[model samples]
Target: MDDDEVLLRGRVYGTDDGAPDSRPLPGRSYRELVGGPLDGLLLDVTGWDAGQLSGGAALMTELGRYGGGGRAHYGPRAGDPRCWDWAGDTP
Candidate 1:
């Protein structure tokens, strides 16, 4: 089995003590999300394809203004390859 597809249960960030560390694990890479509710959060982009990295993704967040569940839309920041700019949010 591919470990990449396996889910290792763990604590949710910001909700538990010592449950998980925020730092990226060895060999993992991330992109910084700027602005919006998920500002400052590092998005794990490990194993992403070229298209995925360029197009970005709508990330789920609990801190959305609408309610407890929503997705924050983001796209690659212009001229910033390692950063994503928040476009908007959706419920």
Candidate 2:
């Protein structure tokens, strides 16, 4: 990825009730409860299983469509760089 690529990272922690709260602060327009870099998003849910990852990917894709950019999917890898190119083959 080029220097133009924006890299945003955040984490999600849940309470004993299994509800997510206290996400990373938004640095862009969209109210990202868990993620950022509002444009040209490259999400890596590789930590999750294939099914879970696919579900999150689909959700992100839908959200991206609404947000005006696009979404891509990637598989799990050791020390994968969180950048545009590192985002594996789309779908």
Candidate 3:
């Protein structure tokens, strides 16, 4: 996938808050946050075919795996990490 697609997914999967902030996350590319701050990442898959969704999911899964271990540094800093943790075995 291209850098733009990776960045777009990163932003979408990073934060939950709708509030705007100028502080950029570590290892995050500025190019991704361009076009003014986004309330949330919006993907319009209105006409996407099943194949397309499958492809997109595969891409996202790979991207998530690539960056998965870096979650501590990449995820939201203020909220409970458990909220974003998807690996289970939470205390």
lDDT top scorer: 1
CA lDDT for candidate 3: 0.31
Mind giving the per-residue lDDT tens digits that candidate 2 earns over 38-63? 23433433345546533333233423
Worst 10-residue lDDT window for candidate 1 reads 4-13
Residue-pair clashes, model 1:
0
* Number of residue pairs clashing in candidate 2, backbone atoms closer than 3 angstroms, sequence gap of 3 or more or interchain: 0
Off by over 4 Å in 3: 1-39, 57-91
The RMSD (Cα, Å) of candidate 2 is 10.3
List candidate 2 stretches off by more than 4 Å. 1-7, 11-67, 78-85, 88-91
Give the TM-score (vs. native) of candidate 2.
0.25
Residue pairs with clashing backbones, model 2: none
Whole-model alpha-carbon lDDT for candidate 1 = 0.69
**lDDT for position 12 in model 2:** 29
Per-residue lDDT over 1-91 for candidate 3, one digit per residue giving the tens place of the 0 to 100 score: 4554544443444334343432345453232211212212333334556555333321123233345332111222134321221231111
Q: Give the TM-score of candidate 3.
A: 0.21
TM-score of each: 0.74, 0.25, 0.21
